[model samples]
Structures are given as structure tokens and as C-alpha cells.
Target: AQSVTQPDARVTVSEGASLQLRCKYSYSGTPYLFWYVQYPRQGLQLLLKYYSGDPVVQGVNGFEAEFIKSNSSFHLRKASVHWSDSAVYFCAVTGATGGNNKLTFGQGTVLSVIP
Candidate 1:
């Protein structure tokens, strides 16, 4: 079955620290992966995505993700952490079977930034 998996349920970090959020996906054809961040009381915002060709895609707010086809994974990364960056990050996948454009999100990873 095709699905998106986020192994980590929560991630904790201090201000000015670096962070890494992992994501894995399964699909029949070339996968389209995405990373979104949501604040405490707001909707999800696009952080990064992977389509084709380039394995690594850059996103907003100094965020970036790498799509490794061999491992069927799309991992998100940040150079430095900030208090504002603290939020729930989600990994999603599209382009599943039957031409479903709807994105399938993982359980989600909550990030807590300690100042």
C-alpha cells in the first residue's frame, strides 16, 4: 500500500540549534513529496516539496528537503532553529494511484523550540 510515514512524533530543540525532520513515502510511480508547517492555531504552510529531476528542493524560511528515490524518503532540514519555527511539521505525498491529487500526510512531528 502507498503511504507517508514520519517516524518521529515530536522533536525538541533550543533556539539557534539545528533541526532535522525525517519523512518516508511509498508510491508506484515517481513520487511528489511535500513538507508543511503549522503553528499553534493556524493552517499548514508549505515548507518544501519534491517533484522530479532535482533530488533536493529549497523552500521558504531557510527550509529545505531532499528526496531520495532509492530510500523512498523525503527529509526536511533547517540550518538554524528559532522560536518562531516551533510548530508541527508534516510530511505529505501526492501522485498516488488513480491520479489522486489529494495529499496524504503523515502523523506529524511536533517541534518545540526552547529559548
Candidate 2:
């Protein structure tokens, strides 16, 4: 079994500011992590993911995430954010067991970009 926690319910940042969304997970053995963003009235889009290798993975929109297995964390980061970046971000973990890839999600963090 696995779980995810996003400590922040909401986050606000200036249009050009950088962003970091925290995520923590609980799982035994190897864990697969992902970051997904949902815009207003839009479906969820995969932002980034980590399963193995490099530990750091690139994502769309200049976003990236690093998997720190020892810390059980996979935090999402952006060098600079635009107003369009405002959305609800979710952290998810998928475990493959018995040929089943089950995903567990976080509560989500709503981001607000101010002009």
C-alpha cells in the first residue's frame, strides 16, 4: 500500500516567481511518483514522473522533479511561473504489483498567480 501527502492546500505566487510543490510518500520497495496539473475546468495532465535512473526528470513547461528515495519525497519545481500556471497540482504514486499499476493521489495544491 502507498499514500501521498501535500501539506499545502493552496499556494500563491507572483507571475514571474518560482514555484515548488512539496510531496511525501509512503511505500515499501520501489515507488513510482508523478506530478499532475489540472487547469480550471480541464482534465489532469502529467507534469513529471520518476521511476528510476537519474533521480531527476524533466517535464513539460520547464517543470522538473527529483526523486529522493531516502526521504520518500518527490517535489515538483519550476524556475519561473506564468499566470497560466495557476492550477491545481496533484502528487501521485503508482505501484506495480501483480501486474496491477494502482495509483494513489494527494489532496492537491491549488496555485494562484498574481499579476
Candidate 3:
């Protein structure tokens, strides 16, 4: 079974500042990774995903994530953050089968971007 852990429960950043959200996964072999964001009163939106190929993948908006197998981490990074980016971020992982049938999610990290 695979699991994800988000060290930071909450993060605050000033508008226009760079942001990085840490995510660590526990799995024996390569697993599917995903980052999802939830805005106020909205469903979870897919920010980025990693299955194979390039270690670094670009996502919606200015969000990007890098898969570092050695560190068992898939951290999310944004060159610049906007006030609207404030939301709850979740890191999830699934087995080789793919799909959400056996997905495991982290506790989630709340991001607050101040103007």
C-alpha cells in the first residue's frame, strides 16, 4: 500500500512570492502521484500529476512539480503565487493500476496568500 504525508498543515505567503509545498510518499516501487487543489466551496481540481517520463511536469496555472525518486518526494512549486491561489492542497498516490479505486491522500495543506 502507498501513502502520502504533507509536513506542513498550513502555509502563508505574500502575493507574488514563490511557493513550494512539500509532499513525501511511501511506496516500494514507482507509483502514480497527484496534486490537487480545492478552492473555497469548490471541488478538488487537478493541479499536476506524475506517472513516468520527465521527472518534472507542468500543471495548471503556474504550478509545477518535480518527482525525485531518490527522495520519495513530489514537491509542488510555483514561481509566483497570487492571492487567488489560496486554497487547500492535497497530495495523493495510487498503485500501478491507475484510477481512483485505491487512492490514498494526505491530510492536506492549507495555503493562504496575502496581498
Best by lDDT: 3
**lDDT, candidate 3, residue 83?**
93
Question: Given candidate 1, what's the lDDT at residue 113?
Answer: 92
Model 2, 114: alpha-carbon shift in Å?
0.7
User: Where in model 1 is the C-alpha error above 4 Å?
Assistant: 96-98
Global fold similarity of model 2 (TM-score)? 0.95
Query: Taking the tens digit of each residue's C-alpha lDDT, what string does model 3 give over 76-112?
Result: 9999999999999999988766455577899999999
Compute each candidate's TM-score over C-alphas.
0.94, 0.95, 0.95
Q: Is candidate 1 or candidate 2 better by lDDT?
A: 2
Ranked by lDDT, top first:
3, 2, 1
* Pairs with steric clashes in candidate 2: none
Q: Least accurate stretch of 10 residues (summed lDDT) in model 3?
A: 94-103
lDDT by residue for model 1 over 1-115, one digit each (tens)? 5699999999999999989999989888867789999998899988887778788899999998998888988999999999999899999998834675888899999999999
> For model 2, how does the per-residue alpha-carbon lDDT over 1-115 read when each residue is reduced to its tens digit?
7899999999999988999999999988688889999998889999988878999899999999999888999999999999999999999998745537888999999999999
Q: What is the lDDT, from 0 to 100, of the residue 62 in candidate 3?
A: 86
